[model samples]
Target: MKTRAITGFFFIVVMVGAMLLGAEVFLGFFTLLSAWCLFEFYGIVCSEDRKPNKFLGILTTSTLFITTACYSLGWLEAKFILLFIPVLLAIYIHALYQKRDFPFNDIGFTILGILYVGFPFYCFTRLGYITGDFNHFLPLGFMILLWTSDTGAYLAGRSLGKHKLFERISPKKTWEGFLGGIILAVLVSLCLAYYFQTIPQWQWIVTAVIIGVFGTLGDLVESMLKRSLNVKDSGNILPGHGGFLDRFDGLLIAGPLVYLFLYLAN
Candidate 1:
């Protein structure tokens, strides 16, 4: 318990600190973070006989992320994102020569790593610079809402949970916990609306709702992945936190949606 708490504390610190540091730090930090998460995803899916072209996958993903970062940082135009296409195409071409039985399966999972893990993080970087100027509050607020929702659900579920939310995917989650997350997230959104005038009150509340719903979905999706793979955790890099994927799974699905909403909102 102490180890989990300690790891979580530092995790929060690094996350919050990176955002508060400014645009470059936020972009640089998350760029590496995106790559690490993709690497973990590949590790989970790959085996000896069937495996992704990890070198190409990472190269393609990193290219996409770096291009996204460049655009977000105003170093290049959005058209620079096209640079990822060639590297991505390289994945398919490279797979042909590997002579594996399930080459397409390998290719499919490689791309899945990008869509499932990489693209959302790309959207995440865009969120910080959505307004043409880097404002940390939007991205930071997203994390705060996600963390708050998770905490609320855990507490409420432990105390009042009865009916399971998705027993097949995640046995511990409950409908009661879901509602608890929504309620607390709404409350926190109100406070954010009060303090951060960049976004309207109703919008903040709506963002909270999005985080609660989609974030839980993200957690469940990752849980489903792990369960299918017959693994306990994604990895143990974070000590008690399992792995980067376990810690950031909620962000995976919720992030892209939030980015879309915020992009349209602005």
Candidate 2:
């Protein structure tokens, strides 16, 4: 318990600092994180008996993330992202030369990793610059709301949980916990609206609700992946936090949804 608490504190501090430091630090940190998460995803999904071009997978995923980050920062043009199409096609071409069976499966998993991990982190980068300027408030505020929701759910589930939210996928989650998370997220959104006047209170509340719902779903999705793989945790990279994927699963889904809401709202 002490270890978990210590690790959690340091993790929060580093993440908050990176987000506030500037766009460069934020992009570099998350781009590396996205790549590592992709590596972990491939490691879990592809067993030793069936290797899925880890080198190519990592290369393509990293490229996608870097591309997205550059585009988000206006350092690269929109057409540069199109370059990924050929790079992805190279996966298929490489599969043809390999002697592995289920090459298509390998291809599929590789592409899935890019979509699952790369695209969402891309949205995270987009969130930082969503307002045509690099404003740390949206990304930082999003994390605050997500953390609030998760903490609320855990506490409420321990205290007042009665009904299981999703028994098969995640047995511990409860309806009480889910509601608690949403309520807390809404409250945090109110605070963000007050302080970060760039976005209105009502929009923040709506985005908070979206984060609560989708963030829970994101957690469930990663849980389902681990359950399917028969693994207890994604990886041991974060000590108490399992892995980068486990820690950021909520952001993976919620980030994109929140980005969409902000884009549409604006």
Candidate 3:
């Protein structure tokens, strides 16, 4: 528990500091982070006969993230993102030369890593630049709500949990915990709205609700992935936190949802 708490504290500090630094640092940090997460994803699914083209996968994902981030920052045209298509095609072409029996399966996992890990981080990066400027508060506020929701759920589940939320996928989660997450996230949204009025108060509340709901779904999705892969954690990169994927899985689903909401509403 102490190790977990320590790791969480440092992780939060580094994340908050990077985001608050500026747009370039924010993009650079998450760009590497997304790549690292992709690497971890590949590691989890690889086997004797199924080996994803990790180099190509990481390269392609990093390219995608960098292009999207550059476009968001107004440093590159939207067409640069089209480059990602060709890189993905290259992954397919590269797989054609490999002597694996299940080449297509490997290719599928590679692309899945890109979509599952890279795309969402791209969306999270976009959150910082959603307002046509580098406003750190939006992304930071979203993360704050996410953390609060997770904390609330854990605490509530431990103290008052009874019925399981999804026993099949995650036995530890409880409906009571889920509601606690939502309630706490909504409360935090009020604070976010007060300080960062980039979006309306109602929007923040809605974003909180989105984080609570979709974030839990995201956690379940990752849990499902691990269950299928027959693994405990994604990797041991984050000490007690498992890996980059475990720490950021909630952002994967919630980020895209929040991005779409703010983009469409804006």
Candidate 4:
């Protein structure tokens, strides 16, 4: 409880500061955080049964950092898109060289792991770069939805959770908790939507609806990864919470999704 409180307080302070400052600052900080998280994810994956390509890991992480830096400073978006092809080709060529044991699947896993964690996070830079009537609520609003949903799910699951949501991937998750989280997120979204007077209430409703649902999928994806890796927690950086990745996995997944929704709505 103490651990959670302190971490929560620090997280709120930093995020609030970032939100108040401006998009570029947030982009810079978020890029660093996402890079660290990517490195952590790759490290954890490589620790699993199959050894992932370390050189490829470094390459992907470096490319992602540079790409995000470019996007944050508002340059080379088209050029960065082209960067993906070379990554793919490198993975294939490396797979051919390391075909002594298991064949292409290992390389595929490395590629998927890197791209999945890296590219989606890059979208956050895209989001923060947007300027609009709502003071670029895209990033802030998504964080609110993700955090509130996570809190709701935790509380609901602890109190009244009876039915399993996904026993295989997440044994502790409950449908009731998931629904409760969505409900809570919707109410918060409605309040923020009204206060900001940005988009219509319907859009806020849609935002909360999609985020609440997909955010769970994001959590489950990481949970499944941990389970496959046969680990209890992703990492132990956060006291009470396992790691930054463990805590924000859902946000990592849902942030890009919410950004896309806001972009399309606008």
Task: Specify the highest-lDDT model's number.
Answer: 3
Question: What Cα-based lDDT does every candidate model obtain?
Answer: 0.90, 0.87, 0.92, 0.74
RMSD in Å for candidate 4, one decimal?
Answer: 2.9
List, in order, the clash count of every candidate structure: 0, 0, 0, 0
Model 3 scores worst on lDDT over the 10 consecutive residues at 65-74
For model 4, the stretches where C-alpha displacement exceeds 4 angstroms are 47-49, 61-65, 68-72, 75-81, 95-100, 130-136
Candidate 1 lDDT by residue in tens digits, 1-266: 99999999999999999999998999889989988999999999888655977788888888988887788777899999899999999888988798888889899999999999988888888887777788999899999999999999999999999999999999999999999998999999999999877788998998999999999999999999999989988899998889998988999999999989988988
Worst 10 residues of 4 by lDDT: 127-136
Off by over 4 Å in 2: 48-50, 72-74
TM-score on alpha carbons, each prediction: 0.97, 0.95, 0.97, 0.84
Ranked candidates, highest lDDT first: 3, 1, 2, 4
The TM-score that candidate 1 achieves is: 0.97
Clash pairs of candidate 4?
A: none
lDDT score at residue 99, model 3, on the 0-100 scale: 74
Candidate 4 or 2, higher lDDT:
2
The candidates, ranked best first by TM-score, are 1, 3, 2, 4
Candidate 3, residue 125: CA error in Å? 0.4
- The candidate that wins on TM-score is 1
**Reference-based lDDT, residue 8, model 2:** 96
Q: Give a tens-digit lDDT track for model 4, residues 1-266.
A: 99889987897788777866875666667666666676677677763345667567557655766665665556767468457568656877877776547755567667666666766666655655445321656667778888888889889989999999999898999998899899999999989787756667888888888789988999999899888878777677777777677867786677677778867877
